[model samples]
Structure formats: C-alpha cells, structure tokens
Target: MIAPLMKQAGRFSETTVDGEVVLLNLDDGAFFSLTGTAAEIWALIDGARNREAVIAELAARHNADHAAVAADLDPFLADLQARGFLAGA
Candidate 1:
C-alpha cells in the first residue's frame, strides 16, 4: 500500500514569519509556532509527501542519518497529530 500523505488541519490559519510557521487554530483559539527544523518539517507536510519522503529530505538537508532523522520525526509528527494540527489522510 502507498504511504499516507501528511497535511495541515483545515481549522488552522498559517503564516510564515522570519522562517517560522505560525499556526492559529480557529477551533481552540490557540496559536502554535514552529521554528528551526520544526518549521522545515511543518512546511514539508503539504498533503503531497509521505512520512518517509519527508524524513529522507530532512536527513539530506541536515546531513544527518536517515534513521536518526526518522527517529526524531516520529514524535514531532505524533505531537502535531495529537494536538489536531494535522489532518487525517
């Protein structure tokens, strides 16, 4: 089966400021901000790339190990999912 694509939640209003992604959740009236590598990861989840593809790109961009980046990526993505920042695919 094909890997699921990652996407931002529709309830969020997002903007990039100084290289960071700022997300406002209209449902909860809360603001979330992602910077540094987190911003990069957030930017990559555009409903087109799968998780592994994102990890690979991040690994190459940081010159880090694929396994290591994948390790780090899981929890960040999970947290985003838990917080309802990600849309179901």
Candidate 2:
C-alpha cells in the first residue's frame, strides 16, 4: 500500500515555515495548512513510513500512548485522503 501522502507528492507544493506546513494543490489551486500535531505529522511523511510507523514515531516523540495517538490520527489521515491531500491505499 502506498503511504497515504506519497503518491500525491508531485501534485502539491509544500512549504514549511516555523515548523508548520502549507501545501498548495497545483491542480486545484486549493491549499492546506498544518500546524501543531498536524505539522509534526506532516514532517514524518517521507513516502517511506507506513501509517503504523508514523504513529509509533509520533507516540515515542511525545511519550504518548500509541493507541491514543492513533485514535485521533487515523481519522485525520482519512480526512486528508478524502481531500486529495493524501493517496489512500
């Protein structure tokens, strides 16, 4: 399965400023901004980490429970996929 944000890397222009991300969809001229935990998640999406890996790393970084992070993160990823910001498997 493709990492959710991998396939569409070419379709968006990503800019990071002060630990935040702004993604501009080239095809649609729509943009998305990421900050806080969202920015942290965006930084980990390197087209190599699977969903679990991403979650685990985030959990470790925050000394958080893996399941707890997943609870919030999975839905956010799904929303991004639905918005064409991510490529769902």
In TM-score terms, which candidate is top? 1
Q: State, as a TM-score between 0 and 1, how close model 2 is to the true structure.
A: 0.85
- Candidate 2: what lDDT? 0.81
Candidate 2: C-alpha RMSD to true structure equals: 2.2
Clashes of 2: 0
Tell me the spans in candidate 2 whose CA falls farther than 4 Å from its real position: 1-7
User: Model 1 clash pairs?
Assistant: none
**lDDT string, candidate 2, 1-89, tens digits:** 53434546677888998887998888899988999999888777777888888889999999999999999888988877766777762
What are the candidates' C-alpha RMSDs?
1.7, 2.2
Best by lDDT: 1
Instruction: Give the alpha carbon lDDT tens digit for every residue of 1-89 in model 1.
Output: 55665665577788999998998887898899999999988878877788888888998898999999988998988888867788653
Against the true structure, candidate 1 has what lDDT? 0.83
TM-score of each prediction: 0.88, 0.85
Worst 10 residues of 1 by lDDT: 1-10
What's the CA error at residue 49 for candidate 1, in Å? 0.8
